[model samples]
Target: MDSAVLSGRSLSRHFSVKGAAAPVEAVRDVTLEVAPGALTALVGPDGAGKTTLLRMAAGLLAPSGGSLSVLGVDVAARPQEVQDRISYMPQRFGLYEDLSVQENMDLYADLHGVPADVRRERFERLLHMTDLARFTSRPAGKLSGGMKQKLGLACTLVRLPELLLLDEPTVGVDPLSRRELWEIVRQLVEQERLSVIVSTSYMDEAERCQQVFVMHQGRLLAAGAPADLRSRAEGLSFTAVPRTGNSARTLQARLLDARDVVVDAVPEGGHVRFIRRPDASDGAVAQLLDGLPVNPVPARLEDGFMMLLRAAPPPPTLPTLPTSPTLPASPALTPPAASKPARAAGPAGGADSMIEVRDLVRKFGDFTAVASTSFSVARGEIFGLLGPNGAGKTTTFRMLCGLLPASSGFLQVAGVNLRHARAQARAKVGYVSQKFALYGNLTVRENLDFFGGAYGLYGQRLEQRTSQVLEEFQLGGQEHMPSGQLPGGFKQRLAMATGLLHEPEVLFLDEPTSGADPLARREFWRRITTLSEQGVTVVVTTHFMEEAEYCDRIVIQDAGKVLAIGTPREVRKQADDAGNMEDAFIRIVEQNRNGGAP
Candidate 1:
C-alpha cells in the first residue's frame, strides 16, 4: 500500500441543504487504493459517492474527514501539486461546439500549459489514438455522440499526467463506441503504464478492470478482483426457460417480483437468468420458477453485484406487482386469450398491427437519415429499435411518434395514417425523449398538471389522473417536492408517469435507462412488462444490447439502413448463433461495415 498511486483512508463528504433535516452524507467512512499502471473501476448507482471520491482525489473538492495521498503528496494540504499530476474527465467533458477538432485540442493543450515544441507530436499521437485524425478540421458540434466522446478523451490526454480519472465515459454512447473508448483506455494503461480509476454503470465494463470497488448509499459495499466477486454467486445462479405460453420478459418479471425467493432476474438468450435468495430453499425456488425447466449457469459479475446490493433495502419508490403466486396474473398486465400468440416475423400472435412503416425515409438537406425501412408492431408487443450512434434510430423514432415528418413513405400508428393525421396519431402515443423534458423547478404534481393540461385533460379528470399515477408509480409522498430535487430513480419514474397520464395506446422510450444502475433498470423493466401485458404496445430504443432480449422482436440498423430484423433468438441465429445479443449485434454491424453478411 505504500507504493499505491492513490489512496484514501476513512474518506467522507457531507453537504447541508436548505430544507433538509440533516446533512446529505455523500461519502462515509470509506477507504480504497488504486494500483500503478493498472485499470481500476469504481462501480455504483447514482448518489453512491463515486464522483465525490474522484473529486477529492483530483483536489477539486476537500473531504470532510479523512487523509488522502496522491503520488506520495498529501492532497488535502497541497491540492495544487496533486492537481497538476492528474487528469480528470468528469461525466460532462467541456468542449467548445463551434471549434474544430484541432482547435479544441489546442485549447486543452494551452490550458494545461504544454510547451509549443511538445504540441505537434502529442496532438498527432492523441488524434490518431482517438481515430479523430481524419476529422481534425471538422467542427466539434458536427461529430456523432461516439466521436465526440473520443474527441473528449483526446483532449483529456493533450498532456498525460501521473494518473487518469474517467467518470462514466461510455454512459450515452452506443455499444460500438463503448468498445472503442475502452480500447483507447486499455492501450493507455498497457502501453503508457498509466494509472487509472474510472466509475461506471456497466457491469461488463467493470469486469474488464483488474480490481473493482463497489459502492452504495455513500459506503463501500465490497472491493476485490472481478473473478473473486463472481464467486459470491457461484451456487445461486440459474437460467430458466419459460413455459410454452409465456415470453422471457413475462417470466423474468414474475421472478423479480418474488423478493423472498429471488434477488434479481433478467432476460437473456430466450431464457430468464435469476439469482435465488441465499436463504431460500430449493422448493421455494422451484415454486417461483412455476415449473419451468431450469439449469445452473456460470455466475457473472453482474450476479455478484446484484447480490451485494440486495443487502441494502430497495427504495419503496417504484410500483410492484402482487406477490400472491408464481407469475401472479395482474389484470392490468395479462394479455387476453384471443391474441396471445407471438410471431417471429410479424406482430405478436394474430393481433392487429399498432405501428407500420414502409419505405420510410427522412432527409436532412442532402443526407438521408432514414433509408427505406419497413416494420410492424403488434398491439401488445415490446419492439426494440437498435443501432449505433448516428445510425438514424432517433430519426425513425421521431417519425413514428409524429414529431418529425418523414420525407417519403407510408407510416401508421394506432390505425391513424401519419401523413394525413399526424396530429391524431400523436394523441394516441406517449413519448419520453432521451433526456428528462419536465420543468425541474416545478413540484412533481405541478409538472404533471401542466403536461396533463397540454394533453387536453382538465378539471376533475386531470386531478384524478394525477392522483392515480402518484400512487401507481409510487410518487405520492414526494408530490410536493421540486422535480429537480428528486433522486435519479424518482426522476425517471416521474418522466414515465407524465407520459402515461393520458393513457396512450403506444409508449415510445428512447434509451430510457441509459445511465441507470442495474437495480433501477430491473424495476423499470418490470413496470414496462406490466404495461405490455395490459395491451399497451411499447416501442423502445436502447444502447444496452442485453435489453434487446426483452423485446419480442428487434430491428438493427446501420448507416441509415436496416441490417437485420427478428426475435432475439432469430437475430442471434442470423449471426451464426453468437453467444449473446452483444456479440450478435457487434458481429452484424461489423459484417455490414466490412461489406459482407454473417
Candidate 2:
C-alpha cells in the first residue's frame, strides 16, 4: 500500500513577464512526500513561494519542469480528475458576499456535483462545526473576518474531498478564531482520514502538523518533524533578562542590530529571547549581552526558522534609530476632525492617562458592537487590545481615534475629547491599518513622499522625513520598487514607515504584524519599545497572543464585551494553566464563554 497522498519530484514552476530581464522562478526543483491522513505544513516568510507551491500541488498551476502527483494521479496531466478529489482554499477565497450563508454553500455544492442525499448531513455538520447554524440566512458580507474564514472552509468541504489545501487561512484572524478553525480541520483529518497541506506564517500552527517543510525564496530549505527542527538549534537559543534600569527591549535591539553575529532577538514576558549563531566564539557571544541574566531554554519551531533564515542572505538592512526622534504634525496627515495637536492637561491625573474610555457603547440597530468598555492608558505605555475577530476591537479603536462615533461613552485621546475635538485627537496620533493602505501602483519612495506631504511636510522637510523613515525601516533600495510587488514583510514595513513620517504623540497599530515572519516580528516590536520609552503612548491590537506579553498591560474582549484586563503575569495567574500566553488566553476565553470570569 503506497499511502502517500501527494508527492513531488524535481517539481519547478516559473513565470516570464514582458518587461522582466529574468524569469521569476516561483518554485525550484523540490522533492517531498505527504502521506495519507497526515497534516503537513509549509511555513516561511512572505514571498517565500508557499502559495505558488500549494497551487502546483493542487493542479491549478502547471509545473514548468519535473513531475507531481496527487492520490496516485498525475496532477499536471489529469488536473480535472485530481481536482474532483480535493478541496483548495486559496489565500483570498472567492465567496459570494451578497448571497446568504446557506446559498453560498449550496452553490459550491452544485459546482462540485454533490448529490442531494449527501448534502443534508454534510451541511448540518459543517454549520454546527463552524457555529454558522444561526447565521444561515445572514448575508456573507455581514459576517466577521473569522466567521467568513469558517464559511469559506465550510464551502470547500461541502463535498468529502480526499485531500484539503488551506493557504494561510488565519492570516488576519484573532487567536480564538484561529483555534476554532484549526479544531474543525483536525476533527476532519482524524475522523475522515483526509490528508491536508497548509501554508502558514505561524510557527505554532506549523508545529501542530505531523510533518513540516521550511521554504525560503522559492527553495525548500529543510523538511522534518517539528521536534527535529527544534533540535537543530537547541543549544544556541537562550532567554535573557536585562539588569534593572535596562529594559529587555533595549537588549533585544542591541542584539538584533548586531545582525553580523546574532540571528534574532525579541521581547517575551519581560525577557529578551534570542538565537545566537552556532559558530560564534564564546567571547563574541559573551560580549554581545554583557551584564544580562541569561539562561538556556528549550528551542522551538521558531528557533529553527531563525536558524535557517540566518543561513540564507540577511533580510533588508534596517537603519539604526536615534534615542530620540522628532515628528511634526501637518494638516494633511491629521484627521479632518483633529486639526491641531492637543497640548492641554492629560485625561485624568495629568500625564497618567493619555487615553481614556468610560462606559463606551456602540450599537448597530438592535445589536451592540461594544458594551460599557472602560480602560485608561498612561503616557509611555504599550497597551494591547486583543480578542476574537469581530469582537469589537476595531470598533473601540475607531471610536478612540474619532473615526467612528460611540453611541454612549466618553472618549479622550492625548488630553482631548475624541468626540468634541476629533481633529486635535487625530493630529496627536498615527495609525497603521490591518490592510496595506498605501497606493499599490506607486513606488515606495513615492508613497512615503505622498504621506509626508499629507503631514504638512514640504520641500526639505519632506525630503528629510522620507530619508529618515527609509533608513529606519531598512528600505533604502526599495525606493523604485512598486509597493504592490514588495514582499509581505516589506509591505508591512512600508506601511509603518509612512505612518511614522509625521511623528505623532501616539501610535495605533491594528494587527500590524499579522502575516510577518518571526524575524520581522522581532524587528517590528524592538522599534515599538524604543518609541514607548521616548514618552510616546502606544495602543495596538493583535491576533498573536505572545505579543501581549510585551505590553505594559492588555485587555481581552469577546462578544463585544471586556473579558479581562491586566499584565501578562496577572492574566496568566488567573488562568491557573501552564502560564504560556496561549494557555492563559484559552482558559480566559473558555471561562468567559461558559459564563464565568477570571
Candidate 3:
C-alpha cells in the first residue's frame, strides 16, 4: 500500500461526553488505503461515525490513536499543510444566501488564490459542467435546492485540491439533480484525474465508486469492490409478486415482520424484492411467501448492505418507533383557497378525489413557479410528487396544503375547497417537514406533548394519545432522550408520530426519508402502507425514485408544469421503458426539456 494516495494504519478517534461512563469511540481500529485517482465510498447509517472519519482524513479532527497519512504526509502533526491540499465538503456547505452566484464563486476563488485568468477559465468550465451557467446572476437564495448544491460544488472547485472529500452530498436532493451532480463528479474524475472519497447512504452511488468501505458503530465491517459485496447475497435474493388483490407493500410488511426468515424486504415496481435468511427453515420460507411466485433476482449493493448488517451486532437500542404524535404542518405551507372549483372527478380523483388540483398556477413576478397543473388523488391513495430540484413540486404542495396562494386554479382537499375553508381543510391533514424543526433541548416526550397540545389534545385524552403513539412508533423507551440527540431514523419516527397524533385523514410527508438508511426507509413505507389500508390519503414528495414504487400514482413535474402523471408502470412506459424509475424519470425530464417524448 506504499503507492496509496491516502493510507490509515489502525486509525481511531474518541470523544469524551460529560456523563458517559466511557469516552465514545468515533473511529476505532480502522485500517485502509485509498489509491490515487480513484473514487472511493464510505457507506453507513447516520451516527455510524462516517462524518468523524471524513473529518479525521481532512485533518479537521485529530485521531486519539493509530496513524493516518495523507499524500504521504503525517496529517496529525501538519494539519495546516494537509488542509491546504484537500477540499472537504461537509453535509452542510457554507454558502452566502445574500450573495449572487457569481459573487460566491469569486469569493472562493480569491480565498484559494486563484488568479484572475485562471478564475475566469475555471468558473466558465465549472459553471458549464454544473449546468449553472445561466444562473450566475441570480441570488443564491433564490436558486432551487439542486441549483444551490451545484453552486456549492463550483465554489469548492474554484481551485482544485489534491483530494476531494464529500459527505452525503445528495442527502435531500431530488433524483434528477442527484444524477446531474454525479455526472459532474464523474467528469471531474475522468478529465482531471482527481481522487475523491465520498461517504453516502445511497447504495447505487457506492456501486459507482471503485471501492467501498462498509462501516458501523465506528468500526470497519468490511471493504471491497461492489461485485464482491453483491456476491455475499447471491442465491438468497428474490422478487415476490403479490396475489391479484394484494399490494406489494402489504406483502413486504408480512415478510419483514417474519424476522426469522426474511433478511430485507422492499417494494419495487409493485412487487416485493427481498432476501431470505440463510439459516431459516424451508417451511418458514414457504410460509412467509404465502404461496406467491418467487423469482430469483440479482443481488444489489443494498442487498449486500442489509446482509452485512444482519451479521453485525444490533445497535444499543431499538431505534425505530412504530408511531409518534404527528408533527404540526408548517405554518404558511397550505395554499390559500381556490376561487373556482367543481371540476369533474374521474375514477382516480373526480368526485371521489381526496386531493384535487385543476388549471393550477402560481407566479412570482414574471416567473410562474407552477403552471397549469391538474391532477386528482383518490381516497386512500399514496400520491407521490416527483421532480428535479427547483421544480414546482414544492409550489404545488404549498398550494394544496394552503400555505401559499395559487395564482389561479381550483384546489381541493377531502372535498373541501382550500380557497374558502382553509382552517377546516387543514384540520383534516398532518404534515412532516423536510427539516427537523423540533426544539433541540427538549426531550422526545416533551416535544410530543407540546405538539399534541397544539393539536388541542390535553388532559387525560392527550396523554392517552401521546402514550399510544409512542408505543406505536416503539419510542416509549426513548421518550426521555433529547430530541436533538436522536439518530436519523429515530428522529423521523418522532416527526411522523407528531404528525399522526390527531389521526388526520390525510398526511403530507415532504422528503420524510431523505437522509435515512435502507432499514429506516422500509419502516417508513410500512407505516404509510398501513395508513393507506386504514383509508388515509397520503401525499408525499421525495427525491428517492425507488420510494415512488410504493405509491399508487406519481406525478412528475419540471420547470413549472406536470411532465407526466400516472402509475409507476405507466410513467415508465411513457419514458419509453427506461427500465427503472430513476432512468424513466431522467429520460422523461430530458425529453420534455428538449421538447419531445416526455
TM-score of 1: 0.93
The local lDDT score (0 to 100) that residue 131 gets in candidate 1 is 89
Candidate that would win on TM-score: 1
Worst 10 residues of 3 by lDDT: 331-340
The lDDT-based order of candidates, best leading, equals 1, 3, 2
Better of 1 and 3 by lDDT: 1
**Higher-lDDT candidate of 1 and 2:** 1
Higher-TM-score candidate of 1 and 2: 1
Worst 10 residues of 1 by lDDT: 320-329
Q: By TM-score, how accurate is candidate 3?
A: 0.91
Stretches of candidate 1 off by over 4 Å are 315-351
lDDT of 1 by residue, 309-408 (tens): 9977653332221321122223332221213344333354334889989999999999999999998888878999999998999999999999999999
Ranking by TM-score: 1, 3, 2
**lDDT string, candidate 2, 363-459, tens digits:** 9999999999999988777888988777898999888877898899899988899878888788778888888688988878889888877767789
Model 3: per-residue lDDT, tens digit, 1-598? 8878789999899886433446667788999999889899999876678999899889999999999998889999999898889888888999999999999999988888889988889999998999888888899999888888888888988888889999999988887788889999999899999999999989999999999999988899999999999999999999998997666767887888787899999888667899999999889899777789989999999999999998889766633243433443322211111112323212475566788889999999999999999998987788999998888998889878878878888989987899888788877788898886677788889998988887777899878777767767767666666787676778887898888888777788989988787867876787777677667778999999999888888999999989899988889888887667888898988998888944
Model 3 regions lying over 4 Å from their true place: 16-23, 318-347, 350-352
In order, what lDDT does every prediction score?
0.86, 0.82, 0.83
**What's the CA RMSD for each of the models?**
4.6, 5.7, 5.8
